[model samples]
Target: MPELDSSSMTNPGSKRSNNEDCFLSLPAQDLWMVADGMGGHDAGEVASAIVRDTLAKYPDLPLSESIQRAHQAILDAAANGIGAEGMGSTIVALKHHGENFEIAWVGDSRAYQFTPELGLQALTTDHSYVQMLLESGAINSIDAESHPDKNIITQCLGSQEMETVRVDSLTRPWQPEQWLLLCSDGLTDELSHAEISAILQRYRTPDQATRELVKAALNAGGRDNITVQVIAAPSQPKPSMRAALAHWVPIFTHSRRLDAIIYTLALLVLFALLYWTIF
Candidate 1:
């Protein structure tokens, strides 16, 4: 199995006193997520946290199901949860399933894939009005960046029941030396694609990239809560001996239990056969 190296951070940013964004980086489970929140009375954080906490239960699950569960969680919380009725959050998650990378999202949070060969490519699209207009050829990238309604998202996890929950997803083969960047609108709102790509090209490790990228975004203008998760797989991932042992410890324990059960069953069968033959 390939090993994942990743780093994550969430900052209140230069503007917000409270950070409503939440992120998860679990290399062992091959799961990464970033959720940007919105609401009044600081309820936004609760909504985003609910999504993150809910998804934590099943890290190995596909993004579609996880997001769906998150949506329901938010709704359930709203029945009695303070400030949860209108609380909403946008999510973008990347799951490493076997050899494929599954990228999923709702609202405007994004996941980006970068490699020397491909440079940088956005793996998930925003579910915002500006994005819709951009896709319809009604606006160009330059115009969409400054569009008046740029922040108006069409889908998100919230209290309201959506007629249909649609989670956008993509599956790409996991390749060596490939890096994935998961973040909320905070980073993209300030840093352009070229700017982000420049930072990624500069850093060799996910941990370094994670810090520098957040710093650069803050310098540019951290207007919203900034959350980032950087994940990279080396050309040939080799975990440290200690790390390898830690990962295998649980498997070894389970194997031992299974072996004992099998041995017991075999002994029982053999004894019964012998008794029948003698009698």
Candidate 2:
């Protein structure tokens, strides 16, 4: 199996006094996360910290389950009166397993995938009122991005209703040599998809890409807390003849052709057995 290369950066942005965002990067575990804390005062920071700590605590768990644990922790903290008034946080996480990836998130924080062939595509949907309106045809995408309610997220951790708490998720085969980007809404609010795609295309390494992304977002206004994470799958390696055979042999064996042949043989045997009994 191949390994993943990852890099991350976080900033308070131009207007904020302190950064309330938190991130987790565990390349060995092939897990990465970003959380944007909400609520005034330091409560936001506390919520974000709890999200990060809880999400990273169990590397062995699935990404969805990890987020569930994180959400519960925030709920617990809120009950204890630890700067938890109206406190909640948005989270986006990606876990690489074998040749597939697991993605889970809440609120407006998002994940994106970029490849030279496909350009840039969003992997997760924003859980905000604007998103809801856009989906309902109440507002166009251009209007939604700049809407007043764009920042008002519909779901996140620390909410009183735990039963309704759920993380949106997606799983797909990992595209090798592709770039995976995750960030808080601060970066997206400031930069457009084309701008982010350009920066990702220009930079070769995850560190360079993530740095330039945050820098560009700050230069564009930086109204909120910003955090960026980038992960790249290892480049494809040339396979030897033996390795190639090992990879494709199983696929061929279980393909539609083999199934058709087996079905045909079974039908023929049944026909012959019936003919012998009748004779």
Candidate 3:
């Protein structure tokens, strides 16, 4: 299995006095998650904490099932008066299995994939009123960004109206040197996709990328709790000497670069002579 490198950060932001955001990083289990809570007082904090703690306890569970369990747990807490009546949270969870990974999410806490080839790609869609408007052609991407209802999510965990949460999920083949980012809306609200892509491209390491992302968001006016988790696949290993020779032989033979062709021919001739002498 390819090795994984990961980093995570959470902050209350410039306007918020308390953070209602939470994240979980279990590299041993190849699982990571971020939750953004909603409600008044400390209820939002309780809602998001329940999501993080529950998923942390059951790291091996399927992403959707675990989130469902979290939904019930949150509802149970509210019923028992653990939090306010309308407390809830948005969640995005990712898990890796060998060369493949699965991601599941609810509400607007987003999952994104970044690669050198593709830059930054959103892995999960937002479950929000603004997203609906954009999809229906009632609003454009620019309008959605500044929409007054942009923060109004359509569904989330711990909603009194939803007995069974609707979890959106997808599985994809993992690639070397790729990054998976899970973050709350606070980060997205502050930074545009272009800004985020530039930051990721600038910082190759997961730790530096997460730190710079949070900093940029704060600089852009952090109006809500911000949380981010960045996971990177191991860099592809360099080819062995024999493998290098095998790869170059074909390319060099077809190349117009005289020095490269001569170098490859000399290496081949040396190997052939050595083989005959040994035999």
Shift of residue 59 alpha carbon in model 2, Å: 1.3
True-vs-predicted CA distance for residue 245, candidate 3, Å: 1.9
TM-scores of all candidate predictions against the true structure: 0.82, 0.84, 0.88
Where is model 2 more than 4 Å wrong at Cα? 241-279
Please tell me which predicted candidate would have the highest lDDT against the true structure: 3
Q: For residues 32-85, could you state the per-residue lDDT of candidate 2 as single tens digits?
A: 999999887789999999988887789889777878888888888888888767
Alpha-carbon lDDT, every model: 0.85, 0.87, 0.92
Ranking by lDDT: 3, 2, 1
Expressed as tens digits, the lDDT of each residue in 4-90 for candidate 1 is 788999998998899889997777888889998888546899899888998898886778998899988887787776555788899
Cα deviation of 172, candidate 2, in Å = 1.0
Cα displacement (angstroms), candidate 3, residue 186, comes to 0.6
Could you tell me the TM-score of candidate 1?
A: 0.82
In the order shown, the candidates' Cα RMSDs to the true structure are 13.6, 10.3, 6.0
| Backbone clashes in model 3, listed as residue pairs | none
Cα-based lDDT at residue 90, candidate 2: 93
